[model samples]
Target: MDTVLKINNLYVGLKDMTIVKDFSLDIHKREIIGIVGESGCGKSTMLKSIVGLSDNNVSIQKGKIDFHGVSLRSMDQNQLRSIRGNKISFIFQKPDYTFDPVMKVKSQFFETVKFHTDGKANKKDCYKRSRELLEQLHFEAPDEVLESYPFELSGGMNQRIAVAMSMINEPELILADEPTSALDVSVQSQVVRTLMELRDKTGVAILMVSHNINVIASMADMVGVMYGGRMVEYGDAREVLQKSRHPYTKALLDAVPAMSQTMPESIEGAPPRFSEILQGCPFRERCPFSENKCETEPAIQGDASHWWLCHKQ
Candidate 1:
Protein backbone atom coordinates (compact mmCIF):
# COMPACT_ATOMS: atom_id res chain seq x y z
CA MET A 1 0.00 0.00 0.00
CA ASP A 2 1.14 3.54 -0.74
CA THR A 3 1.74 5.95 2.12
CA VAL A 4 -0.94 8.59 2.48
CA LEU A 5 0.49 10.64 5.39
CA LYS A 6 3.94 10.86 6.94
CA ILE A 7 4.93 12.65 10.19
CA ASN A 8 8.65 12.77 10.93
CA ASN A 9 10.25 13.76 14.25
CA LEU A 10 7.38 16.05 15.22
CA TYR A 11 7.92 18.29 18.25
CA VAL A 12 5.00 20.42 19.40
CA GLY A 13 5.35 22.64 22.44
CA LEU A 14 3.66 25.45 24.37
CA LYS A 15 5.52 28.01 26.52
CA ASP A 16 8.64 25.81 26.50
CA MET A 17 6.73 22.72 27.60
CA THR A 18 6.67 20.04 24.93
CA ILE A 19 3.45 18.17 24.36
CA VAL A 20 4.73 15.93 21.58
CA LYS A 21 8.35 14.85 21.09
CA ASP A 22 10.05 12.97 18.32
CA PHE A 23 6.78 11.55 17.06
CA SER A 24 6.98 9.84 13.67
CA LEU A 25 4.32 7.94 11.81
CA ASP A 26 3.39 6.68 8.34
CA ILE A 27 -0.20 5.90 7.39
CA HIS A 28 -0.74 3.81 4.28
CA LYS A 29 -3.68 3.79 1.88
CA ARG A 30 -6.73 1.93 3.25
CA GLU A 31 -4.85 1.15 6.47
CA ILE A 32 -5.80 2.10 10.02
CA ILE A 33 -3.26 3.24 12.64
CA GLY A 34 -4.47 3.36 16.24
CA ILE A 35 -2.65 5.45 18.85
CA VAL A 36 -3.38 4.36 22.41
CA GLY A 37 -2.22 6.22 25.47
CA GLU A 38 -3.42 7.81 28.68
CA SER A 39 -5.03 11.22 28.29
CA GLY A 40 -2.68 14.19 27.67
CA CYS A 41 0.07 11.99 26.23
CA GLY A 42 -0.10 14.16 23.03
CA LYS A 43 -2.28 11.88 20.89
CA SER A 44 -4.84 14.63 20.18
CA THR A 45 -2.09 17.27 19.93
CA MET A 46 -0.30 15.26 17.27
CA LEU A 47 -3.53 14.79 15.29
CA LYS A 48 -4.23 18.53 15.37
CA SER A 49 -0.65 19.46 14.38
CA ILE A 50 -0.78 17.19 11.32
CA VAL A 51 -3.55 19.35 9.84
CA GLY A 52 -2.34 22.75 11.10
CA LEU A 53 -5.10 22.85 13.73
CA SER A 54 -3.06 22.94 16.92
CA ASP A 55 -4.01 25.71 19.39
CA ASN A 56 -2.51 29.21 19.20
CA ASN A 57 -0.11 28.63 22.08
CA VAL A 58 1.19 25.35 20.73
CA SER A 59 4.08 25.72 18.28
CA ILE A 60 5.58 23.19 15.90
CA GLN A 61 9.11 23.32 17.26
CA LYS A 62 10.50 20.82 14.75
CA GLY A 63 8.74 18.50 12.31
CA LYS A 64 7.62 17.64 8.85
CA ILE A 65 4.02 16.71 8.19
CA ASP A 66 3.40 15.49 4.65
CA PHE A 67 0.17 14.41 3.10
CA HIS A 68 0.31 12.69 -0.28
CA GLY A 69 3.85 14.08 -0.78
CA VAL A 70 2.74 17.69 -0.09
CA SER A 71 4.59 19.44 2.74
CA LEU A 72 1.85 20.49 5.17
CA ARG A 73 4.26 22.36 7.47
CA SER A 74 5.31 24.69 4.67
CA MET A 75 1.76 25.45 3.46
CA ASP A 76 0.03 28.76 4.25
CA GLN A 77 -3.43 28.99 5.79
CA ASN A 78 -5.17 29.15 2.41
CA GLN A 79 -2.98 26.39 1.01
CA LEU A 80 -3.68 24.22 4.04
CA ARG A 81 -7.39 25.00 3.79
CA SER A 82 -7.38 23.81 0.17
CA ILE A 83 -5.98 20.44 1.26
CA ARG A 84 -7.98 20.18 4.45
CA GLY A 85 -11.42 18.47 4.19
CA ASN A 86 -10.75 17.77 0.49
CA LYS A 87 -7.70 15.51 0.80
CA ILE A 88 -7.60 15.12 4.57
CA SER A 89 -10.60 15.34 6.93
CA PHE A 90 -10.93 15.43 10.70
CA ILE A 91 -13.46 13.85 13.10
CA PHE A 92 -13.19 15.80 16.32
CA GLN A 93 -13.79 14.20 19.71
CA LYS A 94 -16.91 16.26 20.34
CA PRO A 95 -19.49 16.35 17.56
CA ASP A 96 -21.36 19.30 19.03
CA TYR A 97 -18.21 21.42 18.90
CA THR A 98 -17.77 20.66 15.18
CA PHE A 99 -21.01 22.44 14.25
CA ASP A 100 -23.00 25.54 15.00
CA PRO A 101 -25.70 24.83 17.55
CA VAL A 102 -27.93 27.60 16.16
CA MET A 103 -27.60 26.47 12.56
CA LYS A 104 -29.75 23.74 11.03
CA VAL A 105 -27.96 20.50 10.32
CA LYS A 106 -28.93 20.60 6.64
CA SER A 107 -27.44 24.07 6.23
CA GLN A 108 -24.16 23.16 7.93
CA PHE A 109 -23.89 19.93 5.99
CA PHE A 110 -24.47 21.78 2.73
CA GLU A 111 -21.88 24.39 3.66
CA THR A 112 -19.31 21.68 4.41
CA VAL A 113 -20.02 19.94 1.11
CA LYS A 114 -19.82 23.20 -0.77
CA PHE A 115 -16.55 24.13 0.89
CA HIS A 116 -15.00 20.85 -0.18
CA THR A 117 -16.58 20.78 -3.64
CA ASP A 118 -16.29 24.53 -4.30
CA GLY A 119 -20.08 24.85 -4.79
CA LYS A 120 -20.06 22.13 -7.45
CA ALA A 121 -22.52 19.95 -5.51
CA ASN A 122 -26.03 21.38 -5.54
CA LYS A 123 -28.41 21.09 -2.60
CA LYS A 124 -30.11 18.03 -4.06
CA ASP A 125 -26.83 16.19 -4.64
CA CYS A 126 -25.49 17.09 -1.21
CA TYR A 127 -28.63 15.93 0.52
CA LYS A 128 -28.73 12.73 -1.47
CA ARG A 129 -25.11 11.88 -0.67
CA SER A 130 -25.44 12.90 2.98
CA ARG A 131 -28.56 10.78 3.43
CA GLU A 132 -26.89 7.83 1.71
CA LEU A 133 -23.82 8.11 3.94
CA LEU A 134 -26.00 8.47 7.07
CA GLU A 135 -28.09 5.45 6.14
CA GLN A 136 -24.94 3.49 5.44
CA LEU A 137 -23.94 4.22 9.05
CA HIS A 138 -27.31 2.71 10.17
CA PHE A 139 -29.04 6.05 10.67
CA GLU A 140 -32.82 5.97 10.48
CA ALA A 141 -34.80 8.83 8.88
CA PRO A 142 -31.75 10.63 7.56
CA ASP A 143 -34.00 13.49 6.44
CA GLU A 144 -35.06 14.27 10.02
CA VAL A 145 -31.45 14.13 11.09
CA LEU A 146 -30.56 16.80 8.57
CA GLU A 147 -33.42 19.09 9.59
CA SER A 148 -32.64 19.03 13.29
CA TYR A 149 -30.05 21.14 15.10
CA PRO A 150 -26.87 19.46 16.37
CA PHE A 151 -27.92 19.99 20.00
CA GLU A 152 -31.24 18.25 19.33
CA LEU A 153 -29.52 14.99 18.44
CA SER A 154 -28.15 12.54 20.97
CA GLY A 155 -24.41 12.13 21.46
CA GLY A 156 -24.26 8.90 19.50
CA MET A 157 -26.39 10.31 16.68
CA ASN A 158 -24.23 13.43 16.44
CA GLN A 159 -21.11 11.25 16.42
CA ARG A 160 -22.53 9.21 13.53
CA ILE A 161 -23.27 12.45 11.74
CA ALA A 162 -19.69 13.53 12.37
CA VAL A 163 -18.48 10.35 10.75
CA ALA A 164 -20.82 10.92 7.82
CA MET A 165 -19.61 14.50 7.43
CA SER A 166 -15.98 13.37 7.40
CA MET A 167 -16.81 10.80 4.70
CA ILE A 168 -18.86 13.23 2.61
CA ASN A 169 -15.70 14.55 0.93
CA GLU A 170 -14.26 11.09 0.16
CA PRO A 171 -10.90 12.18 1.49
CA GLU A 172 -7.68 10.18 1.12
CA LEU A 173 -6.98 10.37 4.87
CA ILE A 174 -9.16 10.75 7.99
CA LEU A 175 -7.87 11.91 11.36
CA ALA A 176 -10.16 10.90 14.22
CA ASP A 177 -9.53 11.86 17.82
CA GLU A 178 -11.27 9.41 20.17
CA PRO A 179 -14.22 8.96 17.82
CA THR A 180 -15.85 6.38 20.09
CA SER A 181 -14.72 7.56 23.50
CA ALA A 182 -17.97 9.32 24.35
CA LEU A 183 -20.44 6.57 23.41
CA ASP A 184 -21.96 3.58 25.16
CA VAL A 185 -20.68 0.06 24.60
CA SER A 186 -23.24 -0.89 21.91
CA VAL A 187 -22.93 2.46 20.16
CA GLN A 188 -19.14 2.23 20.30
CA SER A 189 -19.29 -1.18 18.62
CA GLN A 190 -21.63 0.20 15.98
CA VAL A 191 -19.35 3.16 15.29
CA VAL A 192 -16.33 0.86 14.99
CA ARG A 193 -18.17 -1.32 12.44
CA THR A 194 -19.21 1.77 10.53
CA LEU A 195 -15.58 2.99 10.36
CA MET A 196 -14.35 -0.44 9.26
CA GLU A 197 -16.96 -0.57 6.50
CA LEU A 198 -16.15 2.99 5.45
CA ARG A 199 -12.46 2.09 5.09
CA ASP A 200 -13.38 -1.01 3.11
CA LYS A 201 -15.70 0.87 0.78
CA THR A 202 -13.59 3.98 0.21
CA GLY A 203 -10.05 2.67 0.79
CA VAL A 204 -9.28 5.78 2.90
CA ALA A 205 -6.49 5.61 5.42
CA ILE A 206 -7.35 6.49 9.07
CA LEU A 207 -5.25 7.67 11.99
CA MET A 208 -7.29 7.36 15.20
CA VAL A 209 -6.54 8.11 18.84
CA SER A 210 -8.17 5.96 21.52
CA HIS A 211 -7.59 4.94 25.11
CA ASN A 212 -9.53 1.72 24.66
CA ILE A 213 -7.25 -1.17 23.85
CA ASN A 214 -10.13 -3.34 22.62
CA VAL A 215 -11.14 -0.76 20.05
CA ILE A 216 -7.56 -0.46 18.77
CA ALA A 217 -7.16 -4.25 18.64
CA SER A 218 -10.36 -4.63 16.64
CA MET A 219 -9.70 -1.98 13.98
CA ALA A 220 -6.02 -1.09 13.72
CA ASP A 221 -3.61 -2.63 11.17
CA MET A 222 -0.74 -0.91 13.01
CA VAL A 223 -0.54 0.34 16.61
CA GLY A 224 1.47 3.06 18.35
CA VAL A 225 1.80 3.21 22.13
CA MET A 226 2.54 6.69 23.51
CA TYR A 227 4.15 7.64 26.80
CA GLY A 228 5.10 11.15 27.97
CA GLY A 229 4.46 12.65 24.54
CA ARG A 230 6.63 10.13 22.71
CA MET A 231 5.91 6.85 20.91
CA VAL A 232 7.10 4.10 23.25
CA GLU A 233 6.26 1.22 20.94
CA TYR A 234 5.06 1.03 17.38
CA GLY A 235 4.47 -2.10 15.34
CA ASP A 236 1.91 -4.55 13.95
CA ALA A 237 -1.15 -4.34 16.20
CA ARG A 238 -1.09 -8.00 17.15
CA GLU A 239 2.63 -8.01 17.92
CA VAL A 240 2.66 -4.80 19.96
CA LEU A 241 -0.45 -5.74 21.87
CA GLN A 242 0.30 -9.42 22.44
CA LYS A 243 4.10 -9.61 22.15
CA SER A 244 4.86 -6.16 23.47
CA ARG A 245 8.56 -5.19 23.50
CA HIS A 246 8.69 -2.03 25.62
CA PRO A 247 8.09 -2.15 29.35
CA TYR A 248 5.47 0.62 29.12
CA THR A 249 3.64 -1.30 26.37
CA LYS A 250 3.69 -4.46 28.47
CA ALA A 251 2.43 -2.55 31.50
CA LEU A 252 -0.38 -1.03 29.45
CA LEU A 253 -1.47 -4.43 28.17
CA ASP A 254 -1.33 -5.83 31.68
CA ALA A 255 -3.64 -3.02 32.84
CA VAL A 256 -6.42 -4.11 30.49
CA PRO A 257 -9.16 -6.35 31.82
CA ALA A 258 -9.61 -9.93 30.58
CA MET A 259 -12.16 -12.63 31.38
CA SER A 260 -9.47 -14.75 32.97
CA GLN A 261 -8.56 -12.08 35.48
CA THR A 262 -10.89 -11.52 38.44
CA MET A 263 -9.69 -7.92 38.82
CA PRO A 264 -7.98 -5.61 36.39
CA GLU A 265 -4.66 -4.16 37.58
CA SER A 266 -3.57 -0.58 36.97
CA ILE A 267 -0.11 0.68 36.13
CA GLU A 268 1.71 2.07 39.15
CA GLY A 269 2.28 5.84 39.48
CA ALA A 270 0.62 8.55 37.47
CA PRO A 271 1.93 9.47 34.05
CA PRO A 272 4.40 12.35 33.93
CA ARG A 273 2.79 15.69 33.16
CA PHE A 274 3.47 17.30 29.77
CA SER A 275 5.46 20.09 31.41
CA GLU A 276 7.51 17.80 33.61
CA ILE A 277 10.86 17.36 31.92
CA LEU A 278 12.83 14.38 33.15
CA GLN A 279 16.56 13.63 32.92
CA GLY A 280 16.40 9.88 32.33
CA CYS A 281 13.59 7.87 30.73
CA PRO A 282 10.31 9.75 31.13
CA PHE A 283 8.76 6.49 32.26
CA ARG A 284 11.68 5.40 34.42
CA GLU A 285 9.86 6.16 37.65
CA ARG A 286 6.89 3.99 36.74
CA CYS A 287 8.79 1.28 34.84
CA PRO A 288 9.17 -1.94 36.81
CA PHE A 289 12.02 -3.08 34.55
CA SER A 290 14.07 0.05 35.17
CA GLU A 291 17.76 -0.52 35.86
CA ASN A 292 20.71 1.77 36.70
CA LYS A 293 21.21 2.42 32.97
CA CYS A 294 17.64 3.65 32.82
CA GLU A 295 18.85 6.76 34.69
CA THR A 296 20.20 7.89 31.31
CA GLU A 297 17.89 8.44 28.35
CA PRO A 298 17.66 5.23 26.28
CA ALA A 299 18.08 5.15 22.54
CA ILE A 300 15.24 4.02 20.28
CA GLN A 301 15.79 0.43 19.16
CA GLY A 302 14.09 -2.17 16.94
CA ASP A 303 13.44 -3.41 13.42
CA ALA A 304 11.98 -1.10 10.76
CA SER A 305 8.49 -2.46 11.24
CA HIS A 306 8.55 -2.80 15.04
CA TRP A 307 10.39 -0.32 17.25
CA TRP A 308 10.70 0.79 20.86
CA LEU A 309 12.30 3.64 22.82
CA CYS A 310 14.00 1.68 25.55
CA HIS A 311 17.43 0.40 26.50
CA LYS A 312 16.13 -3.04 27.53
CA GLN A 313 14.05 -3.73 24.45
Candidate 2:
Protein backbone atom coordinates (compact mmCIF):
# COMPACT_ATOMS: atom_id res chain seq x y z
CA MET A 1 0.00 0.00 0.00
CA ASP A 2 2.89 2.32 0.79
CA THR A 3 6.31 2.48 -0.83
CA VAL A 4 8.98 0.99 1.38
CA LEU A 5 11.82 1.12 -1.17
CA LYS A 6 12.51 3.00 -4.39
CA ILE A 7 15.39 2.26 -6.78
CA ASN A 8 15.93 5.07 -9.29
CA ASN A 9 18.16 4.59 -12.31
CA LEU A 10 20.18 2.09 -10.38
CA TYR A 11 23.37 1.01 -12.18
CA VAL A 12 25.76 -1.78 -11.27
CA GLY A 13 28.89 -2.82 -13.12
CA LEU A 14 31.76 -5.17 -12.47
CA LYS A 15 34.79 -4.11 -14.49
CA ASP A 16 33.50 -2.28 -17.58
CA MET A 17 30.57 -4.59 -18.35
CA THR A 18 27.35 -3.17 -17.04
CA ILE A 19 25.30 -5.88 -15.39
CA VAL A 20 22.38 -3.58 -14.63
CA LYS A 21 21.73 0.02 -15.59
CA ASP A 22 18.81 2.43 -15.43
CA PHE A 23 17.08 -0.13 -13.26
CA SER A 24 14.30 1.25 -11.13
CA LEU A 25 11.76 -0.38 -8.87
CA ASP A 26 9.16 0.41 -6.23
CA ILE A 27 8.44 -2.04 -3.45
CA HIS A 28 5.41 -1.47 -1.25
CA LYS A 29 4.48 -2.74 2.17
CA ARG A 30 2.68 -6.11 2.23
CA GLU A 31 3.27 -7.05 -1.42
CA ILE A 32 5.09 -9.73 -3.40
CA ILE A 33 6.90 -9.06 -6.68
CA GLY A 34 8.03 -11.98 -8.85
CA ILE A 35 11.03 -11.41 -11.14
CA VAL A 36 11.00 -13.82 -14.09
CA GLY A 37 13.58 -14.15 -16.85
CA GLU A 38 15.88 -16.54 -18.68
CA SER A 39 19.07 -17.71 -16.97
CA GLY A 40 22.05 -15.29 -17.25
CA CYS A 41 19.71 -12.34 -17.60
CA GLY A 42 21.27 -10.68 -14.52
CA LYS A 43 18.29 -11.37 -12.23
CA SER A 44 20.40 -12.87 -9.45
CA THR A 45 23.08 -10.21 -9.85
CA MET A 46 20.52 -7.46 -9.32
CA LEU A 47 19.17 -9.14 -6.21
CA LYS A 48 22.73 -9.61 -4.94
CA SER A 49 23.32 -5.91 -5.40
CA ILE A 50 20.20 -5.14 -3.37
CA VAL A 51 21.29 -7.44 -0.56
CA GLY A 52 24.73 -5.68 -0.77
CA LEU A 53 27.00 -8.01 1.14
CA SER A 54 30.77 -7.59 1.60
CA ASP A 55 33.51 -9.80 3.04
CA ASN A 56 35.40 -6.98 4.81
CA ASN A 57 35.39 -3.47 3.27
CA VAL A 58 34.93 -4.43 -0.39
CA SER A 59 31.41 -3.81 -1.80
CA ILE A 60 29.83 -3.87 -5.21
CA GLN A 61 29.65 -0.57 -7.07
CA LYS A 62 25.99 0.41 -7.39
CA GLY A 63 23.85 3.45 -7.95
CA LYS A 64 20.77 4.64 -6.12
CA ILE A 65 19.12 2.14 -3.75
CA ASP A 66 16.66 4.01 -1.56
CA PHE A 67 15.19 2.07 1.33
CA HIS A 68 12.53 3.57 3.57
CA GLY A 69 13.31 7.00 2.05
CA VAL A 70 17.07 6.73 2.77
CA SER A 71 19.63 6.52 -0.04
CA LEU A 72 22.00 3.56 0.29
CA ARG A 73 24.56 4.95 -2.18
CA SER A 74 26.70 6.80 0.39
CA MET A 75 26.17 4.47 3.33
CA ASP A 76 29.45 2.93 4.57
CA GLN A 77 29.94 -0.68 5.59
CA ASN A 78 28.98 0.03 9.18
CA GLN A 79 25.86 1.94 8.13
CA LEU A 80 24.83 -0.80 5.68
CA ARG A 81 25.74 -3.55 8.13
CA SER A 82 22.90 -2.34 10.33
CA ILE A 83 20.27 -2.73 7.60
CA ARG A 84 21.25 -5.94 5.83
CA GLY A 85 20.07 -9.43 6.86
CA ASN A 86 17.73 -7.83 9.43
CA LYS A 87 15.74 -5.63 7.03
CA ILE A 88 16.27 -7.78 3.93
CA SER A 89 17.05 -11.49 3.77
CA PHE A 90 17.89 -13.78 0.83
CA ILE A 91 17.02 -17.42 0.08
CA PHE A 92 19.65 -18.62 -2.36
CA GLN A 93 19.05 -21.09 -5.17
CA LYS A 94 21.20 -23.98 -3.92
CA PRO A 95 20.74 -24.72 -0.24
CA ASP A 96 22.90 -27.84 0.02
CA TYR A 97 25.93 -26.04 -1.40
CA THR A 98 25.47 -22.88 0.72
CA PHE A 99 26.67 -24.48 3.95
CA ASP A 100 30.13 -25.46 5.17
CA PRO A 101 31.18 -29.09 5.53
CA VAL A 102 33.27 -28.32 8.59
CA MET A 103 30.75 -26.30 10.59
CA LYS A 104 28.02 -27.90 12.65
CA VAL A 105 24.44 -26.81 11.87
CA LYS A 106 24.15 -25.23 15.29
CA SER A 107 27.38 -23.26 14.86
CA GLN A 108 26.38 -21.76 11.49
CA PHE A 109 22.83 -21.05 12.63
CA PHE A 110 24.04 -19.29 15.76
CA GLU A 111 26.47 -17.15 13.78
CA THR A 112 23.69 -16.13 11.37
CA VAL A 113 21.41 -15.16 14.26
CA LYS A 114 24.13 -13.27 16.08
CA PHE A 115 25.02 -11.37 12.88
CA HIS A 116 21.51 -10.06 12.22
CA THR A 117 20.20 -9.67 15.76
CA ASP A 118 20.76 -6.49 17.81
CA GLY A 119 22.03 -8.36 20.84
CA LYS A 120 22.98 -12.02 21.21
CA ALA A 121 19.90 -14.15 21.79
CA ASN A 122 20.60 -16.77 24.48
CA LYS A 123 21.84 -20.08 23.13
CA LYS A 124 18.87 -21.85 24.75
CA ASP A 125 16.43 -19.40 23.16
CA CYS A 126 18.15 -19.66 19.79
CA TYR A 127 18.04 -23.45 19.97
CA LYS A 128 14.41 -23.36 21.03
CA ARG A 129 13.54 -21.02 18.16
CA SER A 130 15.63 -23.08 15.72
CA ARG A 131 13.78 -26.23 16.69
CA GLU A 132 10.44 -24.47 16.37
CA LEU A 133 11.43 -23.23 12.89
CA LEU A 134 12.59 -26.69 11.76
CA GLU A 135 9.33 -28.24 12.93
CA GLN A 136 7.42 -25.37 11.41
CA LEU A 137 9.05 -26.22 8.06
CA HIS A 138 8.07 -29.90 8.59
CA PHE A 139 11.49 -31.14 9.68
CA GLU A 140 11.64 -33.83 12.43
CA ALA A 141 14.00 -34.44 15.37
CA PRO A 142 14.98 -30.94 16.48
CA ASP A 143 18.08 -31.93 18.49
CA GLU A 144 19.46 -34.18 15.76
CA VAL A 145 19.00 -31.50 13.13
CA LEU A 146 20.89 -28.85 15.10
CA GLU A 147 23.78 -31.14 16.06
CA SER A 148 24.22 -32.54 12.55
CA TYR A 149 26.56 -30.89 10.07
CA PRO A 150 25.10 -29.45 6.83
CA PHE A 151 26.81 -32.31 4.94
CA GLU A 152 24.79 -34.77 6.98
CA LEU A 153 21.46 -33.21 5.90
CA SER A 154 19.76 -33.88 2.60
CA GLY A 155 19.11 -31.22 -0.05
CA GLY A 156 15.54 -30.73 1.09
CA MET A 157 16.65 -30.47 4.68
CA ASN A 158 19.27 -27.84 3.83
CA GLN A 159 16.71 -25.87 1.82
CA ARG A 160 14.27 -26.02 4.72
CA ILE A 161 17.01 -24.86 7.07
CA ALA A 162 18.04 -21.99 4.76
CA VAL A 163 14.46 -20.82 4.78
CA ALA A 164 14.30 -21.38 8.51
CA MET A 165 17.29 -19.10 9.06
CA SER A 166 15.59 -16.27 7.16
CA MET A 167 12.41 -16.72 9.18
CA ILE A 168 14.41 -16.40 12.38
CA ASN A 169 15.11 -12.76 11.57
CA GLU A 170 11.53 -11.63 10.83
CA PRO A 171 12.78 -9.30 8.09
CA GLU A 172 10.62 -6.73 6.34
CA LEU A 173 11.58 -7.93 2.87
CA ILE A 174 12.72 -11.31 1.52
CA LEU A 175 14.53 -11.96 -1.78
CA ALA A 176 14.07 -15.56 -2.87
CA ASP A 177 16.23 -16.43 -5.90
CA GLU A 178 14.89 -19.54 -7.57
CA PRO A 179 13.91 -20.86 -4.15
CA THR A 180 12.28 -23.98 -5.61
CA SER A 181 14.30 -24.47 -8.78
CA ALA A 182 16.33 -27.44 -7.64
CA LEU A 183 13.55 -29.47 -5.97
CA ASP A 184 11.41 -32.26 -7.35
CA VAL A 185 7.86 -31.53 -8.57
CA SER A 186 6.39 -32.95 -5.36
CA VAL A 187 8.65 -30.78 -3.23
CA GLN A 188 8.08 -27.70 -5.42
CA SER A 189 4.51 -27.22 -4.24
CA GLN A 190 5.58 -27.56 -0.64
CA VAL A 191 8.24 -24.87 -1.10
CA VAL A 192 5.76 -22.56 -2.80
CA ARG A 193 3.23 -23.07 -0.03
CA THR A 194 5.85 -22.21 2.56
CA LEU A 195 6.66 -18.92 0.83
CA MET A 196 2.99 -18.13 0.39
CA GLU A 197 2.27 -18.78 4.03
CA LEU A 198 5.31 -16.77 5.09
CA ARG A 199 4.08 -13.78 3.13
CA ASP A 200 0.51 -14.12 4.35
CA LYS A 201 1.42 -14.43 8.02
CA THR A 202 4.42 -12.13 8.29
CA GLY A 203 3.31 -9.60 5.67
CA VAL A 204 6.91 -9.62 4.42
CA ALA A 205 7.03 -8.18 0.93
CA ILE A 206 8.70 -10.90 -1.12
CA LEU A 207 10.76 -10.61 -4.28
CA MET A 208 10.64 -14.15 -5.67
CA VAL A 209 13.10 -14.58 -8.56
CA SER A 210 12.59 -17.51 -10.87
CA HIS A 211 12.62 -18.47 -14.51
CA ASN A 212 9.45 -20.55 -14.12
CA ILE A 213 6.29 -18.71 -15.20
CA ASN A 214 3.86 -21.21 -13.67
CA VAL A 215 5.74 -21.17 -10.36
CA ILE A 216 5.14 -17.43 -9.86
CA ALA A 217 1.76 -17.13 -11.63
CA SER A 218 -0.28 -18.12 -8.58
CA MET A 219 1.88 -16.84 -5.74
CA ALA A 220 2.76 -13.26 -6.62
CA ASP A 221 0.65 -10.13 -6.23
CA MET A 222 2.71 -8.49 -8.99
CA VAL A 223 4.87 -10.10 -11.68
CA GLY A 224 7.91 -8.39 -13.18
CA VAL A 225 8.93 -10.05 -16.43
CA MET A 226 12.61 -9.28 -17.02
CA TYR A 227 14.57 -9.54 -20.29
CA GLY A 228 18.31 -9.10 -20.36
CA GLY A 229 18.94 -6.77 -17.41
CA ARG A 230 15.78 -4.70 -17.70
CA MET A 231 12.16 -5.16 -16.69
CA VAL A 232 10.03 -5.85 -19.77
CA GLU A 233 6.61 -5.99 -18.13
CA TYR A 234 5.40 -5.28 -14.61
CA GLY A 235 1.80 -5.29 -13.38
CA ASP A 236 -0.71 -7.18 -11.28
CA ALA A 237 -0.04 -10.91 -11.63
CA ARG A 238 -3.28 -11.70 -13.45
CA GLU A 239 -2.94 -8.73 -15.76
CA VAL A 240 0.69 -9.37 -16.67
CA LEU A 241 0.23 -13.08 -17.21
CA GLN A 242 -3.09 -12.87 -19.09
CA LYS A 243 -2.55 -9.46 -20.68
CA SER A 244 1.20 -8.81 -21.02
CA ARG A 245 2.45 -5.92 -23.16
CA HIS A 246 6.03 -6.72 -24.20
CA PRO A 247 6.61 -9.34 -26.86
CA TYR A 248 9.10 -11.13 -24.62
CA THR A 249 6.52 -11.32 -21.87
CA LYS A 250 3.94 -12.72 -24.28
CA ALA A 251 6.41 -15.32 -25.57
CA LEU A 252 7.30 -16.44 -22.04
CA LEU A 253 3.64 -16.72 -21.03
CA ASP A 254 2.82 -18.63 -24.22
CA ALA A 255 5.40 -21.29 -23.40
CA VAL A 256 3.84 -22.10 -20.03
CA PRO A 257 2.35 -25.61 -20.22
CA ALA A 258 -1.43 -25.82 -19.96
CA MET A 259 -3.70 -28.86 -20.27
CA SER A 260 -5.92 -27.40 -23.00
CA GLN A 261 -3.43 -25.82 -25.42
CA THR A 262 -0.47 -26.91 -27.56
CA MET A 263 2.95 -25.89 -26.29
CA PRO A 264 4.29 -22.56 -27.56
CA GLU A 265 7.74 -21.91 -29.03
CA SER A 266 10.73 -21.29 -26.78
CA ILE A 267 12.24 -17.89 -27.51
CA GLU A 268 14.73 -17.95 -30.40
CA GLY A 269 18.43 -17.03 -29.96
CA ALA A 270 20.24 -16.92 -26.64
CA PRO A 271 20.18 -14.13 -24.06
CA PRO A 272 22.82 -11.45 -24.70
CA ARG A 273 26.09 -11.31 -22.83
CA PHE A 274 27.16 -8.07 -21.17
CA SER A 275 30.61 -6.98 -22.37
CA GLU A 276 32.95 -4.06 -21.72
CA ILE A 277 30.86 -1.50 -23.61
CA LEU A 278 27.31 -0.40 -22.81
CA GLN A 279 25.19 -1.96 -25.52
CA GLY A 280 21.74 -1.21 -26.87
CA CYS A 281 18.71 -3.40 -26.14
CA PRO A 282 19.87 -6.62 -24.49
CA PHE A 283 17.00 -8.68 -25.90
CA ARG A 284 17.34 -7.41 -29.49
CA GLU A 285 18.47 -10.74 -30.90
CA ARG A 286 15.67 -12.75 -29.26
CA CYS A 287 12.87 -10.22 -29.64
CA PRO A 288 10.71 -10.72 -32.73
CA PHE A 289 9.40 -7.19 -32.31
CA SER A 290 12.82 -5.57 -32.48
CA GLU A 291 13.08 -2.41 -34.61
CA ASN A 292 15.79 0.01 -35.76
CA LYS A 293 15.38 1.88 -32.50
CA CYS A 294 16.37 -1.30 -30.66
CA GLU A 295 19.99 -0.97 -31.78
CA THR A 296 20.17 2.49 -30.23
CA GLU A 297 20.03 3.42 -26.58
CA PRO A 298 16.62 2.95 -24.98
CA ALA A 299 15.24 4.56 -21.88
CA ILE A 300 13.06 2.58 -19.50
CA GLN A 301 9.71 4.35 -19.76
CA GLY A 302 6.02 3.55 -19.45
CA ASP A 303 3.14 4.17 -17.06
CA ALA A 304 3.97 4.61 -13.38
CA SER A 305 3.12 1.02 -12.55
CA HIS A 306 3.61 -0.98 -15.77
CA TRP A 307 6.79 -0.21 -17.74
CA TRP A 308 8.73 -1.35 -20.80
CA LEU A 309 11.50 -0.15 -23.17
CA CYS A 310 10.28 -1.75 -26.40
CA HIS A 311 9.06 0.66 -29.07
CA LYS A 312 6.19 -1.65 -30.05
CA GLN A 313 4.82 -1.59 -26.54
Residues 169-227, candidate 2: write the lDDT tens digits.
77888888898899886777778877777777778888888988888886888888777
Global fold similarity of model 1 (TM-score): 0.95
Model 2, TM vs. native: 0.87
* Tens digits of lDDT, candidate 1, 229-313: 9998999988888788998887777788851143667889999998688777889999888899998988878887888889894
Question: What do the candidate models score in CA lDDT, each in turn?
Answer: 0.87, 0.76
Q: Give the best candidate by lDDT.
A: 1
Candidate 2, position 264, lDDT: 76
List of clashing residue pairs for candidate 1: none
In model 2, which range of ten residues has the least summed lDDT? Answer: 53-62
- What's the number of clashes in each of the models? 0, 0
Using all chains and alpha carbons, the TM-scores for the candidates as numbered come to 0.95, 0.87
> The CA-based lDDT of model 2 is what?
0.76
